[model samples]
Structure formats: C-alpha cells, structure tokens
Target: MNATCEPRSPRAVRISSSPAELAGLGTLLKCVQAGVGDVPALLALAKDVGDTAPRPGAGRTALLWEILASVTAVDVAAGRILEPHLDAAAILAQAGGAAAADFASDRVSDRVPDSVPFEGAWGVFAAEAPGLTLEAGDAAGRTVLNGSKPWCSIAAQLDHAVLTARLAGGGRAAFAVNLHAAGVSFADPKWTSLGLREVPSGTVHFEAVPAIPLGGAGWYYQRPGFAWGGIGVAACWLGGAVAVARSYQGALQKAADGGREPDQLALAHLGEIDRTLAALIQYFARTAARIDAGELSGPGAWSEALRVRGGAAAAVERIQTLVSQNLGPGPLAFDPRYAKRMADLSLYIRQHHGMRDDAQLGALTFKGGHPW
Candidate 1:
C-alpha cells in the first residue's frame, strides 16, 4: 500500500468566477480545483468520491456527465485517466458482492489504507489485441489470470484492475486483481504518441496472477452498466471539445483586444460550433433522463449509447476542424497547452470506433423497429 495511492477525505475548497472557469460543474469542480493534477491525486479523488458519482440509470445521470465533462475541460488527459476509474467503481457497485461491500464500507471507515479488498486506484483493462488474450482458470482451487492484456492505460501506476479474461468454457469472465501482486508485470511502455503522454498505456503480462472473479461468464458486457459506461466516455469527449472551442474563442477575443474586429467567417464557425454543441448537450441530457427513467436499459441501452457516442465524437471532430482552420499553425506550433490539448483530444476521440460503431447502431435501430 503506497502512501501516495491511499484515498483520503476530500477537503472543502473555494470557487472562482473567472470566465474560463466551469462553475456549473458544482461539487466535482471544487474537487478538481483543489487537487494537484497528477495520477495519484486523480486516484485519490476517485476513491474519495466512491459510489458518489451517480451511477448511470440510478438517477442524476446528467450530473455524472457534467462531472466527467468538467474534468476533461480542465485537462483532457486527466479526464482520460479519471473516467475509467469512475467507471470501474460503477461496475463494481453493479456487480455487488463481498468485494463491492468491502469497498463501500472501507471508504467511510479508518481501516488500514489500501489493505482492504478493492481499494485505492483502479483501472478497467478490457481491451484485446490480435494474438493477445487473457485467460482465467482454476489453479489449486482458486481462479487465477494468465496471458496478457493490451491498452492498459497507466496500469503500472494503479493499485488494482478489473479486467476480463476468457474462461475455459469459451466465454469471458470479469475479475479484479491486485496489480502489485507477484506474476503481474508490465511491458516497456513504448508509447510514443503526443497525446496522453502522461498516461503511458501498454501491455501487462500475467503468470497465474491470483484474482477475484467479478461476475459470471459474459456478465461484464451483458450488464446495462456497460452501455452506460460507454456513454460516460462520450461525456469526456464532449468536455474536450468544449475546451477546444474555448481556445478558439480566446483567440478571437485576443484578436479583438488588439483592435481587430471579428470577421464573419470566424463568427460563422463559432455559431456553427455553438449550435452543434448545444444540440449534443441536449442529446446527452435526454439520454441521461431516459436512462434514469428505465427507458434506456437492456438492449435499448446499447443503441442509445452508440448514438450519444457517435454524435459526441462527430461534434469533437467538427470542433477540431473549425478551430484548427481558423487558428492556423500558431496554436499547434507554439502554445504548449493548446498543442497538448489538440493532440490529446485527437487521440482520445479515437476510442469512439467511428463508422464501425455507426454500423452497429444502424443494425440495432433496424432490429428495434426504427424508432424514428
């Protein structure tokens, strides 16, 4: 149990009225503002919040999205790292068992830090690559993980991870494992990307690593919370897009301050971005409301999540284009923060799956009788 990875009680903080500040993010905003922006700090914040970030379909889903968006707006990389930790919490809660109970109880008590089951920083490593597969099987009457998992973002830094592994019966089962345990080793972080460089993601190999099975075979993806978690990622994308839009606005303001009047083309682009983002926000709110009302669950959740993610991803691309074309090469070439945001967002949104996801949504819509 590393002292730095221990979750602590959240402190009270003040908010500022700066024009750039996203005051509407509410309590979550204060948490982000008070913390030092780093992996350990983000993990501490995740554990401190514990089951507080309104689980999708449990109600207050809009507020949950706002919190995710606000974090990304402050820093896209932080948003990338935090969203999954929050999602992992939601999944554990939904999976309800001894581990989940222990996690819930440990958060409020003075128990030994990081010694409890399912405490500290956590990640969900479900991504699979070609020729790479993790398997779970019995060994000495206990289930253990073997093989490797890919795209495990900042895995070496986390204390625990909830991942999926193929069972002997030809299906996948979810399991939670301590990353610090023996037989858990990470590959050399060969990440060379400009975006999310702070979060080096790579492969982790397991040699009979002991684990706690989360749910029965196929339960991880079959649960409604899975779709809800996908929607949460879209929320992060929306937040990143908002930050880019703000950068463009800031550039425009600077130009005006220098006695240059706003041009029609730039204003038109801004108007278009505003319109697109406003509509996307409405869509997210509507989806969240439906999810809470039990209207978007089961099979329906899949398509609704796809729609939200697709729309959010498209909105991000459009915002990026508008900002880049108008601002030219100055921001990417000179402004470090701006450049980092651009690079981070460009890579982050790739998680959306683009047209492939669109195709899945199309199939789902046809199967659902075309609710248009």
Candidate 2:
C-alpha cells in the first residue's frame, strides 16, 4: 500500500477530452482557440456566450461551468475577461424584478435594455480599496454612481459593468452602470505584468455616472447566486490548471517520441496532476448538480464555494510546482502560450482570499448544519 509504489498512467495515454466537449461546447471551443490572442475577438466571443450560455442554477449549470472551463483552457486571459461578464449576466437574470428593467437611458442607445440577455461586454468591479470608494447617490432625480472603483478590469473597453457602491443612506448595493455614459472614465494605470497583459485592471472613476440598481441593499452578497458566481471563477482556475497540465503532458509525449523515457519522478508527477484534477472536476460536477437542484440555495453555498475556490487554488499551485520543478525553465522561457498561462494563472488565482477564506470556512464549520 506504499503510495510511491503506485502505478501511473502510461506515457501513451492521450490528453483526455475536457468537460466542454461533453457539454456540447465543442464548436465554441474551436472558435475560442481560433480567436486565441485577439482581445476584441475574445470579447465578442464572450458577449456571444453571455447571450447564449445557460444561466447558473438553471438545469444546465454543469454545462455552464464546462463552457467557462473550456474557455479558460484555451486562453487564460480570455477566460479572465469572460468570467465576470458572464457572472454579471447571470446575476441580472437572478435579480429578475425591477432590477431587470431597461437601465440604458437616453445617453446609450446601443446597449441591451433588458441587460439579462447581454448585448455587450461586461465586467464586475466590486473590490474595495483603502481610500477609493464608489457611492450611489441621487443627482436631482436619477441614481448615479460617484467616486471611483478599484480593480476594474477592461473597464475602458467594456460596454457596461455590474459594480457595488456605497449608498448615500449607508449600505452597499449592486448597480448596472453604462461604462460609456458621461462622467465615466478610467484611470488607465500603467500595467507592467506580462500575464494577462492585454487585460489591464485599472481604476474607474464615475462623476455622476448614471446607474440602475440591480438588487436591494446587501443583496449582492446576500444572494445565493453570489456563491455560484464565485465557484464559476474557480471553474476558470480549474481550466487554467488543465491548460498547464497539458504542457506537462506534451513534454512527456515529446520525450517518449524522441526515445527519452520518462523517469519515475516524472511519472509520479503526472499521476498526481491527473488525480488532483480528477477530484476537482468531480467536485465541480457535484456542486453544479446541487445548484441546479436548488439544494445549495441558502447559506450552505458559502462554504461550498469557499471549498471549491480554496481546493482549486491549492490544486493549481501544486500543479504549477510539479511542472516547474520537473520541466525547468525551457518552457517558461521559450513557450509563449505555456508561459503566458503560467503567469496569468498565478495572478488569476490570487482572487481567492487565501487563508482568510480558509478561516471563514473553518468558522462556518462551527455553525450547525455545516458542510461536513
């Protein structure tokens, strides 16, 4: 029963099909791969998917995550841009009430009035900063977002955003704001990172920028869809890990084809990567099913989301370590796709709150009816 003595997948074992294929997103995957490095094309693809992809908590939640995973596997940056956009759409769909009303005013004639069936690229900007703050206030008659929001990714390029802002009366609420409307501007900070270089997250400033409230005070985090959206981000992380693992798989295949047999350590790393990824994949499937079945519609979903996000972050780090320790710097220096994925994933996974999230999950366990 020695762990080190366990058999591993044969060197000839081909890279398995991803969930996207099984979920019938094969054609979409092909289109994404074809549009790989083009930001505009990728944004268009994201919009198309947001318009067409199934909403979370729907019966096809698994397929939705599969689509997200498939997009990330092809290109991490694209997936980075795509995820929040899709999540924004899904949030609006979940908020179906006065929040779903036509937010587009006289200034913006092109945007989708309904917003649930999104017509343009969207991003979520909810991250808080020390001094920077966005506030929802009434300017004479209409609701307007004033102040600034940090970590607004692709803010200049996105057509709209689902962002959180402090209310004048003292509470946080989610709003659908048109990025192109008057008084909306991006700080356009200097982004020096190589990973996700195309997707720069800068400060977005709103000066009486019109916004339509999506949900009631505290509803953004209070809703179950919030947890679902967080898990969807984890799906992207899982896909990025899959893309990195493929690099390792390709190296093994190349070595074998060139008559250089993989050593035991290499095989062991391969086994570890496969097993870890398999567990994460199954976790996603089960979580998706529960969401679709309405089993995780309450506070329980917070723990579930934290578990997947934490587990995925750890799995990604482990896979990255295994690949880097074994393959050395050749791929890092020479392989653009592989190198970009590594750097992008390293940044993307940081969205997980790390040990703070772990602590939250631990505290949740003390509460009765925890996910044990």
- Which model scores highest in lDDT? 2
How well is each residue in 208-249 modelled by candidate 1, as lDDT tens digits? 877778789999999989999999999999888887887787
Please report the TM-score between candidate 2 and the true structure.
Answer: 0.90
Residue 193, candidate 2: alpha-carbon lDDT:
91
List the lowest-lDDT window of 10 residues for candidate 2.
1-10
Model 2: clashing residue pairs?
Answer: none
How well does model 1 score by local distance difference test? 0.79
Residue range 1-372, candidate 2, lDDT tens digits:
001110122111112334334645656777777787788999998988887888989888877777778688878897898899899888888888445556534333343322333358889988999999999987656687889899998899888899999987888999988788788888966899987887988899988877788888999999999999999999999888887787787788777777877899999999999999998988888888889899999989999999999999999999999988888887777767778888999999999989999999989887764744
Best by TM-score: 2
TM-score of each: 0.88, 0.90
